[model samples]
Target: MKTAAIRALPASATVFPILFMISTVHLLNDSMQSTVTALFPVLRESQHLSYGQIGLIAFMMNITASFLQPLVGWFADKKPRPYILPIGVCFTLLGVVMLALAPSFAMILLSVTAIGVGSAVFHPESSRVAYLAAGSNRGLAQSIFQVGGNIGSSLGPVMTALIFIPLGQKGVLLFVIAAVAGIVLQTVVARWYAAVGAAPKPKKAVAHDEKSALKLSAGKVRMSVGILILLVFSKHVYLSSFTSFYSLYLIDDFGVGKQQAQWYLFAFLVASAAGTFIGGPLADRFGRRNIIWLSILGTAPFSIALPYADPFWSAVLCICAGFVLSSAFSIIVVYAQELLPGKIGLVSGLFFGLAFGLGGLGSALLGEIADHTSISTVMHICAYLPLLGIFTLLLPKDAELRGR
Candidate 1:
């Protein structure tokens, strides 16, 4: 876990620790949030929220998390990441517990805040460690680390289903388990790093000096930023239309129930993880830009072709789409980080936080569009966004233009 270039921790130490750290934080959130959202309609009926209110609540949570990300990234650059981690885990644990016990709007709002707080805290710090782990081969290191995100995502609906059903209140116990587990993991990581014999680097912002402050050169920085935003737009549309809503289409059009759709989604996500795991390392082996563009092109037609399929074909296309989508997640992350090597935390926040935050917005917008237009149209439109991204990729090769 030491930052040194020579004699880095073996893969056993480097990969697993980073993976566990990133995955655990996301695992906690994903496990709980899915349950909360799936049950949201039922909860909303019981709670008597207006559509606006529900939308506002989601917006509140996201905006709160989104706004705080840059500052968190800045702080992570200066602080010991693990030191702050326990607190974030505790916040998630608190939020989940409060959510389980919640009886009123105020309480639920408070719980959402807790969830947002925990989420904001984790992204930047976790990315820092993952980047650190990739000391020599940052791409592979990030691929291993990025697996945590895909695993957590796949588990979200599954765990949520379990928590809400068979496990009942006990399944809700993931909160306590997550909190306690985090404490243990933190202790182990701390000790592991200690044994490796390096004081954890302080996370102070890379901007301490003017040169490194915005070390990214103006031209490359602008291009990279624009590319990320374009990619973000496409990503958001895919997530909203495919990741979140495709199942709904299956259910509505094909009479697939929540469980079946969820299972399919899980399969899609697993395929995606496989893609990312393979893609990142592959990009390193081949070329980052080439792989990235290839994934975009490869996935676009498949995703666009989704609405035309019957159930069986849809699942196949969905899973194929997953591979293409997953491949980009880690690659883009490493792509962003290398572009701003010294600003790993900030870059991670931009890649993950902004991309996802905007994606969430895209999700919401799609939901609203679903109200006025057919879900079919939304899916169709979603299909083309990624295609547009292919044009954006041609702007300048990310590798050639990074960090100015």
Candidate 2:
């Protein structure tokens, strides 16, 4: 009977509509999340916030997501919850509403925590959807899913320049529309997910999956996972510097206006989005290990040059850094998924959680450094983070990952 049920499952195929729809929701979800950082300038001026306080705001949001995501993924792995998709966005909606009206720092922290909780729920499950929907084209599907987030995140600078700077904190109210749209779209995606969940999977495929997962020794698997986590730390901490402080760096160092600083940040983020879109197919063509090594390590030259460049050159170097650095994350996620073939939700949640956890921790620590030292010092220090990418050479080769 079990085998019969398993045999009833449909063969995997690239489901573009579901992938695109979930990608769209990712855009909405991340754009809403980006509002937190986008409002930093406004919040700083309006509330006379210290750099530490600013960092704490990001810490509160990201830490909440980080702690919760793995647990959420664990639970979903045991018992799939299709409706959790739209239900999670409801938390974000509530958070956004609270953020717009939040009058104090404590209130803002609470609001962002709610948004974080929403993110914790959203990512693991959505990634599982992408995995399910991906036939042989997992790379393209994950890229499609991730590029939405990169583009959505890119909007932060644009929102800072156009909305947050002008409208102040109240500008966050605009994202309420985005949250609502996410809920509606997630609902549509949920139905498909439920249907797919009820279908059958082939027994031979299940055996193959089990075999692939056991290809590496337990110690080897543990070591590889540890290496992957360190890579995530390197990638995200460096990125947190840009997302949380790059604009401030420009405003302070080069005497650029706030809006102008945001435009510079915007160029970097847009390049990141383009890189995310490009990275996956390249990985599919080349190999995950090669791309991961090149993508993370490749940014070293550009990043090392950024802190010393003139304002124009700073923007150019940042663009280069963002493009090269951004490509690694989706590839990393896909690679990790390959490493642990059957535990999709748990792996997704763990890595995404690590990304958030590391970024938030880095932001908080860097903010302190900036307060005691200078933003330039912070930039100078963070420039060396990419060099840690040299460790990627330790990861198992793509052929080994295929059990070759």
Candidate 3:
């Protein structure tokens, strides 16, 4: 019925309104997710938790978020489910309530898992919706969609420091308001999606472009994807260091107050949001590979220099790193879509899932390292991860594609 409903409607010219609505939903949803990490300091002090325990919370949440995305995308690709968008937000709403009221660590873990499920459900379908609404400007549409999440992530720490820190765990319940907003927004978007016309058809086994230029065999295709995955790992693991622990790093290393540290985090994430908005347009103009190269590899010097800077200088370095590093992921997603041509959902899910999984694992492992060693040491270690972006050399040049 949903598929038929979509099929009956005509394709939209652009549907910027729907795209913006979906992006707003992404913002609300991710702000709630970012709250988990944002409250680390408060949670640690309140519960007498260790850094490892804090990381474990992130691990539990992100592992579930990451693991199920591919399956969700795979299912959505085969059978479109527009209504699931609001249903997914319901999971997040319930999780928010659970986190607010939970008494034990076990309950917190369960709460995070519920939230993770919502995120896993939300990403692929919403991404497909953005593609449907993209018209001819796929890059701009993707950037607009992604920038919402980055902005939400940027806002989370500030909100946490202001609300959650003073009001205690109960302050988290305030986010239920955002969850409700997400549900209402997503429901409307889902209805619009159901009326957006037929979904993009999936290519059979191989992209036609794969056959024409440079003649990539199955092995080469796999190799190329593997390289992209490695790049994702390098980018995400390094990002995890900041997203999961940067505040703690500031508090411990520089003797910065928790609220001040959050401000620094806000600065970095705002820069990330700006970078995300810029990447897609640049990629659309110059080619995706160029953006990928600059975003992932170009940030290395600042990343390496960040650990050694004073607090003010460190903040500046973080902004610079965030600006450059945050640009690649959206471009990566569009590039992968172009690579496979038809399996948008599957590709979005795979990359998003891997990012979450790596982030979770990296957070957990890095948390343990911080517990055993020092936060400063973790910073220095993560500083060099961006250097691995040199591997981008392995990717095929964008100009070589015979057909886009």
Winning candidate number (TM-score): 2
Taking all chains together, each candidate's TM-score versus the true structure is 0.83, 0.96, 0.94
Q: Ten residues in a row with the worst lDDT in model 3?
A: 197-206
- What are the per-model C-alpha RMSD values against the true structure? 4.5, 3.3, 3.0
| All candidates in order of lDDT, best leading | 2, 3, 1
lDDT of 2: 0.89
Q: List clashing residue pairs in candidate 2.
A: 9-200
Candidate 2 vs 3: which has more TM-score: 2
Error of 1 at 366 (Å): 1.4
Per-residue lDDT tens digits for candidate 1, residues 322-345, read 888767767777776666656667
Q: What is the lDDT of candidate 3?
A: 0.86
Model 3, position 108: C-alpha lDDT score: 92
TM-score of 2: 0.96
State candidate 1's TM-score: 0.83
